[model samples]
Target: MQRDYNLIDSNRQQQQSKRGEFLASAAAAIAAAAVAAAATAAVAAAAVAAAAAVAVAQQQQQQQQQQQQHQQQQHQQQQQQQHQQQQHQQQQQQQQQQQQQQQQQQQHQQQQQQHQQQQHQQQQQQQHQQQQQAAAAAATAATAAATPATAAAAAAATAAATAAAAAAAAPVNKASI
Candidate 1:
């Protein structure tokens, strides 16, 4: 009876030792799995941060490009407006010059007309003076021819002198002569 009791006690001790070793191994495996999960989560977070930074950089680049395009468009519009204004000014200048030329031409024509009128008036005056001189000469010749032959020669001479004085007073124009 003493030997059987010793063998049973030894078997119980061996089973308890084996159970403790299995539990220790299970705890070690759980710890390793937890560490690996934490490492994977950290890597995922870093990747997300990198993607967000890339998206922000792209947006900034696009905004800058848009701003540059807008500025270029404004510059082009200003140039076009200035070009239009210059064209308008040039057209106005051309019109003004044309008007001035027309006015000058009109004035020149008026002056020419006035000169012609003055020449016509001078010609008429010269013709009138010639007619008066011719009439006076005719009157003097008639008196000399119609006088009586028996009359005194002095009386005839006096009549001729009076006629000459009348002709001298009536002075013919050089143009008519």
Candidate 2:
């Protein structure tokens, strides 16, 4: 009976040791699983952060591109406005030049008219002087004819009449008369 009791106790101890080993292994497995879960969560969080960073970078790039496009559009608009202003200034300059040319032409025409009027007045004055000279010559010829009875006087009268007839037949140039 003592030997059977001792064997029974020894078997109980062995069984208890196996149970303890199994519990220890189970706790180790649970700890390993917990560690794996934590690692997986960390990896997931890192991925989320990286994805957020990439999205932010892409948004920033898009905004920068939009701003650059806006700046380019503004530059193009300013260039067009400058070109239009240059064209307007050129047109104004052309108009002023044309007006100046027209004014010069009008002044030249007025000067020509003044010169022609001066020439006409000179011609009229010459014609009046020629008529007075012709009348004086006619009066002198009449007075000599009334007292002329001698042959020499008669010949002088004939020559005077011939000269007067020749003068009437000649074309009068008022400027040279």
Candidate 3:
């Protein structure tokens, strides 16, 4: 009976040793699983931070492009306004030149008309002087032709019809006396 009790006690000690070895291996596997989980979490956090940085860079690039487009549009508007102003100034200058030319032409025509009138007046004065001289000559000729002769000698000639008239007059001979 004592030998059977000793054998039972040895079996119990062996079972306890096997249980301690299995518990120790289980604890080691649990620790390895915890370390792997921690590594994976760190990798996920780094990926999230990189994504945020990329988003910020894209937003900044978009803002710069919008500002450039606005500035270009403003510059184009200013150029257009300046071109319009230059065109207006050129038109005004052309109009002024045209007006000046018209005025000069009108003045030239007026001067020509005045010169023609003066020539006509001079011609009329010359004709009037010639007519006056001709009238004076005609008056002088009429005064000379109006002189009268005496008729008293004719009355005596009636009595000379008789034969006594031959002795009263001495006539000039055809030949020399």
**lDDT to native, each model:** 0.78, 0.83, 0.67
Between the candidate structures 1 and 3, which one is better when assessed by lDDT? 1
lDDT of 2: 0.83
Ordering by TM-score? 2, 1, 3
> TM-score: which is higher, 1 or 3?
1
Higher-scoring candidate on lDDT, 2 or 3: 2
TM-score of every model versus the real structure:
0.69, 0.77, 0.57
Candidate 3 TM-score over all chains jointly:
0.57
lDDT of 1 by residue, 19-86 (tens): 88988998998898889899999999999999999999999999999999999999999999999999
Weakest lDDT window of 10 consecutive positions for candidate 3: 168-177
Query: Clashing residue pairs in candidate 1, if any?
Result: none
Among the numbered candidates, top lDDT falls to 2
Over the stretch 20-77, how does candidate 3's per-residue lDDT look in tens digits?
Answer: 8888888888888888888888888888898899999999999999999999999999
Model 1 TM-score on a 0 to 1 scale: 0.69
Candidate 1 error regions (>4 Å): 1-22, 148-177
Q: What overall lDDT, based on C-alpha atoms, would model 3 receive against the true structure?
A: 0.67
Report the C-alpha lDDT of model 2 over 1-177, residue by residue, as the tens digit.
Answer: 999999999999999999999999999999999999999999999999999999999999999999999999999999999999999999999999999999999999999999998888788667756765775676566656665456576556666765765575355544435
